[model samples]
Target: MEQGRAQNESAELGGNGHDFRPCQSVNFTVHRVGKQGTKLQELDTPRGLACSDTSCFVVDSGNKRIKVYGRRGVMSGLFSSCQTFSVSNSYWDFPTSWSPQDVAVDSSSADGDHVVYVTDLKEKVVRKFSHSGVYCGVFSDQMLRSPSNIAVDPLNGAVIVTDRESRQVALCKPDGGLIRRFTVPGVPRGVTVSPKTHNILVTVEGVSQPAVYTPEGQAIGESQEHENDVLDHKAADLGDLCVDEEGNIIVADRRNSRILLFDPQRQFVGTLLSRKDGLRDPCGVDLLCDGVVVSDLEQHCLFYVRPGVANTSITKPSQ
Candidate 1:
């Protein structure tokens, strides 16, 4: 059975010598106050967030829309009070009843175009749009029942989504063509693609342990490898997760009100951020070039945290 051995060859099966130990109390401070400026820029129950080199896309769940912000925290466009889109096309009509649950950015195109994939939990559909918020099209799959979380493969542009109602995970192309689907034991919550290995990391709804699988849906390790000390599978309230450049998994432990870390081999590393560091029920997390941005439900704001760095504040609006 040829499982794309060459692709898997470069992927390290273990941590790349990164010491999986707890760091000393690092300084954490409020880097950005709210999403942007003004009351409208403020976030209300923001759930899904993803970042790129220049901007951040946040799932403004309460507002039933997605908000885009620059690296310096300025509102981009489309959803702002001053800007409006040409809704002449029926597909571009206002999404008053849509409830966006998650968001991800795909930049693996030959022409270097970035596409944003957003999941509408209320309508059970995944929608695609340009980075500037132009409506593209729906995922249009019958298997996408109650799509919860979504992720994009940076190397191939494959979108992975968990269908809670179907109790399975579906791998689709950027245009929503079904490549394959596989069932898991428990309800899947958060799903992410490992940056170094390209493996799919999935967090179960009621299980603290997360499972890993190859792109072809082959389980990566023993059952014990999925269990960890930092993850609260019992609470099963884990939110969205992202892989760092160092191959570490940063998961939003919503039930514990902190973020947990794990090595590439699915080993428990340590607590990366928590309430002690000023996080309250953090939902979505994404790594920026300079720092990390977390969506906190209790605070109703995005907390910017930098590890092992002196505390500083950036109050200037993005230019």
Candidate 2:
């Protein structure tokens, strides 16, 4: 295994003479095996991933379908092919075709159900489906044109989507009724609900900063320290983001080929995943209590990284 840059434990100090930020070094191992190879379970241009307690869902964008991989055991690691399934139909009730762009898991239904919400760029809607590959319905609205990314509010089961062409974020009820839409300061790319404050966090194109909004579509504030000012056409740009259990926002920094870590207050902590850590154009990220699973667009496969455990051995890629 290759050694990465040694961590700076005393970095990121505040006036109080203490460092509150998480370490910048990656403390996890990497696992590359997924439903690929000669077995015919090839993933084409995987762009999104979402995780639950027992499984990880991948949006095989180019293939126009979602792939579900079940967790084998506590120590079995991520994206095991032993128990897996795929969803191609638009909804469980209808056999319509779909071109999925991103995906999110909503388990906050009134009765506590786990429903998978995927953004269909072709249909311009967020499609709801059960965990077992049963499509429920579409969160349709006339204003939703070119739905790019989605995030589900675990507190209220509301679905939030970033409409790139419209330059706005739409908040909708679980049944697909529009609550309200907030205009993004710039073109919105990725959006996620902060688990700590339940606030809507959005990453805009050509802007290094992220905007924070309330669930009611009210502006809270924008992050100050995350300003990278990278051009939209630049090689290194922002990708999809997700909130970890600790309420920190994990961002996929594409061109940089790494994952960025920020706290609830939107303060930059450090780099979580990077090229030195074996990530290349990692576009989609999802967290687990023990680790994270990311979708590599260039590699066309899912990888598992165990954060917080330094010098962990890298797993060999599957045959």
Candidate 3:
């Protein structure tokens, strides 16, 4: 594809007063992980994904464990819930049955250690873990019914969680203290914070676009429209999402098997990847320095893609 920026265009503003500019077309090189697995590379129904500067974490939902991988896609470590008991006066070990839904990494500790937060669907709480997989504690509240996705605030280190059953979002302190809670328009699927604006971006089911909110639980803006002519769908089954430093939003359209990009002003830029890119049920997404990481539930793997500036292009889904 030809590589260049489009002609300069006039800036526009959205309902939230965000300055919008023309979006540049880009091409992405996709890489697959866990397709040909080692013992540690095998995954099943992986859901949530989060990354720090040095490592990426995957909530291996089917395996009932959290897998850690280095930037180069090598498995560094893993941890799971375990229980010990005494049977016939002998010690017996068994795995704990817990449903881990999503994960978020907090890299704001003063000691330079990253904290991992995982939402437990079965327990209805958010469990905390150290960078090395040690259980720290958990964040629990009567208001949280089904915590599905989570994110951390870049400005204040607050943990944000979305509950689909409750149809609400909660902002909490680093230690899991509830700061505030507010209801959303629909079932919330994903939650994220823009590193540049600190604005919370959430994907709600039945809503055609991701909703934007202020840190104080005030609704701000939403994408005016979606570029969905290729899919011929009126609404997108949005899953997880993340924002880059430039404030661009990367969203996982699970039902369409595509990843989408939106400018800071919540304007649909273009499709980043689709089913042609070997994505099957892209459920979770996180922004990396080089590109973006996506978790495919149906494929039971992850995709690391390095996107670059190129002539705008969109691929139609295979028949």
Candidate 4:
């Protein structure tokens, strides 16, 4: 997940035109073949961002690689040598696909080791791996249909996923056996489950409301309107949901060009950032030690956001 400076610039929103609310001082730099120091993609459209030892693991969707970087967006040698996962076939014995839409890390597989799990959009599968980015394997059986998200349930090593074509969420084992299935409102795009709350949060596409439910699929809240009934959300397209230390939900409101902050109570705290907030079609959103991470699906980059910083300006959050 990536975050940009939440200061400056202008982006149109719902009924009321607004800019981004300054969250904190945040920035990012691209580290690629010719993009050292500062060379960044025109849009840096990354699909997912994972955290490891204060560094960010970003997946470049348009391209076919995953990268690791420091908090300042500096290049770290974590996923530089990582290969692409395919959809129709396998490469280097790894999975293949058209897009790497989402990823999850199995932090508790073996003594808190970081294992990466990526959801190949076109492949409709999730590939698991160890922290070293090894070709562990894929979790596919004949049940998935265009899966958009993946997460490893620490409870029983169940791999949870949400499918777009099926408009439902399915649970599976590493071997790809059907664990359970549940129906959702619409085409669920982004999904997140918290061990503490044992609840899964889903961001539905074409729907302004995000649904929060218990592990058993009981309703907790909906993202239709704010508690005060103010800010009417218009097609949130919540690409990512991150639960913080306090279980607060940091939603990457993709279409809105801003990140929405919600407490575990499902109350809208306020706007985190916007196009002016250094956000550009932010897709993957997750939390790390001291801040939030966002993946720019349009720029192929990972951005960082410190929730407690003084000022975050995104007039040009790019490298």
**TM-score per candidate, in order?**
0.79, 0.81, 0.79, 0.73
Report the alpha-carbon TM-score of model 3 versus the true structure. 0.79
lDDT of 3 by residue, 223-296 (tens): 44454653355457778998766677778888878777666776666666677777778988885444567898
Q: Count the backbone clashes (under 3 Å) in each candidate.
A: 2, 4, 0, 31
- Lowest summed lDDT over 10 consecutive residues: which window, candidate 3? 82-91
Q: Which residue pairs in model 2 clash with each other?
A: 27-309, 28-306, 92-135, 236-255
Candidate that beats the other on lDDT, 3 or 4, i.e. the better one: 3
Please report, in order, the local distance difference test score of every candidate based on alpha carbons. 0.66, 0.68, 0.70, 0.58
Output the number of the lDDT-best candidate.
3
Kindly report which residue stretches of model 2 are placed more than 4 angstroms away from their true locations once superposed: 1-26, 35-41, 81-97, 110-112, 224-226, 229-236, 307-319
Candidate 4, residues 32-150, lDDT tens digits: the string is: 22122222322235776666534555666655555544444322222333333332233332333447777776665567666677777666667765665566777663688887777
Off by over 4 Å in 1: 1-22, 30-32, 35-39, 72-95, 223-236, 308-319
List model 2 lDDT by residue over 1-319, tens digit each.
Answer: 2323423221221111111233444344566645333233667788888876667778877656677777565345554553223344432222347788898888666664688889988888888888777768787648699898898888888888899998999998888998899898778888988766788888887655567888877888754434554322334366788775446677788877877666666665566567776678787887643555778888787767553344433332232
After superposing candidate 4 on the true structure, give the runs of residues whose Cα lies further than 4 Å from its correct spot.
1-44, 70-98, 221-229, 232-235, 307-319
lDDT measured at residue 61 in model 3 versus the true structure, 0 to 100: 81
Clashing pairs in 1: 207-233, 208-233
TM-score for model 1? Answer: 0.79
Q: 3 or 4, which is superior by TM-score?
A: 3
